[model samples]
Target chain A: MTNSQRTPYDGIVMAAPVTIPYVRYSIESAQWWIGRALGALVAQAGIKASDIDGLCVSSFTMGTDSGIGLTQHFGLCVRWLDTIPLGGASAIAGLRKAARAVQARDADIVACVAGDTNHVDSFRLTLENFSRFNQDAVYPYGAGGANASFALIARNYMRTFGVSREDVGRIAVAQRANALRNPHALMKTPLTLEQYLAARPISDPIHLFDCVMPCAGAEAFLVMREETAASLGLPAARLLSTIERHNAFADDPMQVRGGWAMDVGELYAMAAVNPDDLDIVQTYDDYPVITMMQFEDLGFCRKGEGAEFVRAHDLTIDGDFPHNTSGGQLSVGQAGAAGAYLGLVEGLRQVLGAAGPTQVRNARLGLASGFGMINYDRGLASGAAIFAGPSR
Target chain B: MLQRCEACGAFAYPAREACPSCLSPDLAFADAPRGGVLLAETTARVPSDVYFRERVPWRIGLVKMDCGPTIVAHLHTDCVEGAPVRMSLQLDKSGQAVTFARPEGETPNMADDRQWREMTADPKFRRVLVTNGRSVIGQEAVVALKAAGAKTVFVGVAEPWRPFAGEDLLRRQEGVEVVTLDAADEKSAADLAADIGGKVEILVNTTEYVRAGGLLDRKGTSIARDEIDQAYLGFINLAQAFGPAMRMRGADGINNSVAWVNILSVYALANWPAFGAYSASQAACLSLSHCLRAELRPGGIKVMNLFTGPVDTEWFQTVPPPKVAPRAVAQAIVSGLKNGLEEMYVGDVAEEIRQRLAANPKALERELDR
Candidate 1:
């Protein structure tokens, strides 16, 4: 398809996000959380489950079952099905795929859901077998898990950019403040810079505050034509643009930036907006260093200046930047694959004027980005999307 | 070694079969660059797998080599991030090609040296000599050494008049030589050393007298003298006679002696009153072994000392149920010789005593006294 003929996602709306609260550990399975999320999405949309003709699912703990098995279990038939196993980037990937399918008249309504259950052994098991490269190369050193890998990145970033621990502490403290206002956030207690710095080091340079608490939960959203959303009497958040890239800089000895840096300009150009136009920003906050990298790579600042960007901006809901209003994964525990959808679902809630306590005033345009799958030393998948309110 | 593609001039690490960039089968293996830059480093305080659990606080890092391959290598503790490092590939305990990086100007640790690893490999197809071969430990060592593929095994018997239970079977075995020599007699040791000095690649000394008594025993003086004569002086005479020949063989590069193993009692570290004289003799042997190790370093001969608890031998027949089996001790000796370890503790009690002594020697002494 030509660029002109390729469908723009301006009128493709994402509606009816159903989020389940994150629990620290559970014996429940992925199917349980996914069923709850799908059920909640249909209930919030005030539609029958059979009305959904397309499905896109994301889950790391969903053993031996893909979209085909889920379709059979949920008893919903559709022409489009996608199982985006992109870890934390699955949200944007699922949305991009479902939006294109709808634009192509493949399926009218698509249910996008990401969920996972975290047992006591789930996080350890996931890290042990995350990927072949990770299992062989990284796991043998020390079971530092993701914290070890991220710590190395954080150390490199600090050494390169002169970023201090306090610079990242600012993000953690601010996000915890936002989490206090978020009912779905697992960690609602106020966090201070002193506490962030004083926390015990899980890995050197990556303290307790820098790591996300792995928990069990689910997040879901519905992707359909804007007219169909309007007909259902639901407020719609239009997806303006989305970009996903993997293994972007294979030559970099160390990952100072992510794949977002490679495709972020195209993301903004396609949406006809700049970073300044964003009323709210939701970045995957598995680690604050990563958020800083996203800020620099997504064109908020120059390369290697993420620390300065973090220092300059106050990222609370009431602050000028208004980033991660739903507390991000720092305060809101990460629910395996659902972490990819957490920011997207929250961004949709903000633009649709449905974010209860953490909502920003007159939030017309928003940005949500994701990163996932640290297969070896660096994250391989990165994606971002811009959404707008009905006025746009 | 690193592989280079003839078609595209691209380098691939771990010796891939084909070029990753050009998919060409024309690949050549060549020596990897010695220079590398330390990209990032971390000490795994909590090791993820069982293999590294005991070796916690392991320093590992990513090193980008000048030849264009980034490797995950065990970092020398002194190597700083962002600094240039000397890198090389070595086989780990699991026999995998593991990269190791050290700071410039610092010698590579013996643990990460390929030559050291090869030198410590099993004494396969090598001629071996076991002193005091008529004893229980010596017979077990003979069986284990033969099983490990020794080309010829010499059993040095001090007293042929007293027939050992396995002596007939040992004599009937192929490539087994039963030599008559008393370790206490200097002439006998020198004569035996002269006969097989050039061919013997592994020499084991399991000669020890178990005179179990405290310092105040009525026969303590004679017992201590016998123990010293067998354990300490015996090793010294054998080394003095055989060492020169071993060094000459090494100089001439004719399958020289690679290892000298000494089996001693764990009481050498922390003396138990019941075995005080034996402990004193073994302690002296340990000291002499260290000196021998330093002296033999120029000739590339490894000195391995095995400190073990009481074994279920005739000498330790009255020892408690926790005594180690003779076969186990023999196996430990073979492994220690193969791995080229400077020192090893055999049996649970021996390891425990070693740990206790390391933690606090005074406390261990007090515990042994009690």
Candidate 2:
């Protein structure tokens, strides 16, 4: 691919996420959450909803409605539209699609939103019919749900790498401490290592703290030309490089890593930056073990040294390795599809100097990685983006 | 059965129509080897479905079969992670084929094989008969059967003249037929059996004679005799009466009976001396049910034995805390029937007792001795 085709957008101007929390049960539908995110995007960007010529949306419970239906419902005549259902990887997926669309001049302003509402039965129903493979293979075995599947991976990771629960517990406790500064975070209470270790096991090897609390929320961002963002006087984050891979390393007996391992070199090469150069790192923290895996796969550490890396680094917002500064989904509450966008939006916020209390000092360049869609035993989609603040 | 791709020689689980590898439509089904290495295991303390809520703390494992396929299957309690397991295919409650793995040399047809029982649990459109309908558990069973879409529910009353709390409600419900029969009386049981044996698809014996006391109590022997007369003889009479007809029906291909459920107590598994005679009678009943289960296995009629602890009923009004609600037990029975579980330990106390027995029987025995 040509450089223009590869790094299409001059920059991405992301809006503050419209997050709704603690709605463990909601009467509203997926459309309402998506619309709310769109409203927030337009208001934050100081643009009219009608000005949005490109639309990209992601939701798990949207039910037969993709970008086409969303366009009609929101009364938008878009030149480009995409529906990313990549779960945690959706935010980066949406950004990549919208960025390419803008570069191609298909649309000037693209509104990319990912949101979902959690109802009493939505979580269970979603798992039951997640996929034919899950329904037939994984679900029937004790109906262990997602926790059980992740438990298998966590156990194997520990056994293979000699990682202890204390090593993983450090991530959760640190993230909880970070969530204390995030007003939008659901779990603001201080989490001690003792508490994380003692928390009841949902599935063996995965405790309550190890699992993400499913809530209802959304996050959105606006992608447009550099001239457009400059005219609006909005601070923009330059999209240095983004990479996505699916079903990578399908031969592993159990997932000790993700697709990021396969493409991290390409991502760093394209961005012209080393892993050590990034100011802040935002990883998909669906589980602490996954965060450790991302750190290794994204080239922050050597393979099989994730546990050692985690043990050696201080991961709190103010620490040496500023990671998941906005508390991540672990504390922010995973709002269905919004989980995919959480890290990307946070990365944008960090680069733009909008991350209030959890802001890393002198934050300039940031890395955001997403992993999602556990089709059966392991997550299939992985995407990451490196963003740089606009030149002073 | 597992599917193999003729083009690439790759084997796939769930018997897919097309090859996942090589994109070959020429896939063929063949018998899978009964051996696999247990890759991982988890004790699911939380359940995601309504049917599994009562059966929490179930062991599930991922097994990599020797034939180049991995399957998520129910693991036998004896099987641990990293151990080699023998695999067998069994249908789940949804009528979908599911693999079950057990420790090697443990026959899949063993009496404690839970996977074999789950295959027979779905109670949709099956005709049901609940013996001893006067009690709370019996009434709940009838209600659960109706909710599960049983075509017809026959409520067998041992004492027709006695007043029961839910008896009138049961008689008033649609599709419920109340019949009179004394389980201890062979003639009455035979007469009732002759009446509805052909039509009954799910038979549940909830008869119990519990006189709570230790062996030192003056009336203990009489209580034990009555318990034996009612619990054991009652189950035997019902099984003998229904087993023949159920087998014949299975042979006839017209409404083959699905299962026979016995609501015994957890004490039967590990004799709790506090309820000495009651426990002894329940133990006898449990043994008889196993024999009956084996006898009816050829006809595909599952025998579901429920081992529950103290339930919230008049029989256990004095039993404090940790008692299971009658509706919960009833729901469990219906779920058990639908899932075709051979043996189910319901209620928190029962599950605790089960785990205790599995972990250290001598410790449990010593505690009971105290």
Best by lDDT: 1
Give candidate 1's whole-model lDDT.
Answer: 0.84
Tens digits of per-residue lDDT for model 1 on B317-366?
A: 77787888889989998887766567788998899998999899999999
The TM-score leader among the candidates is 2
The TM-score between candidate 1 and the true structure equals 0.68
Candidate 2 wrong stretches, greater than 4 Å:
A1-22, B107-370
RMSD of each: 17.6, 17.7
Q: Give the TM-score of each candidate.
A: 0.68, 0.70
lDDT of 2 at A109: 89
Which digits, one per residue and each the tens of the lDDT, describe model 1 over residues A217-295?
Answer: 9999999998889889988898888899998898888899999988877788778898999999999999999999999
lDDT, candidate 2, B1-370, per-residue tens: 7888889988887567788778899988877678998888877878787656656777788888888877888887778788899987765544356788878875554533544444554566678888878888888889998998878999889778888787779889998899997888888889998888888888888896776776886543666778878889888888788888886554343345777888989988888887767888888988888798778876667778888998887778777888988788889988777555677888899999999999999899778765
Poorest 10 consecutive residues of model 2 chain B by lDDT? Answer: B109-118
Clashing pairs in 1: A142-B48, A143-B47, A143-B48, B120-B338
How high is the DockQ of candidate 2? Answer: 0.46
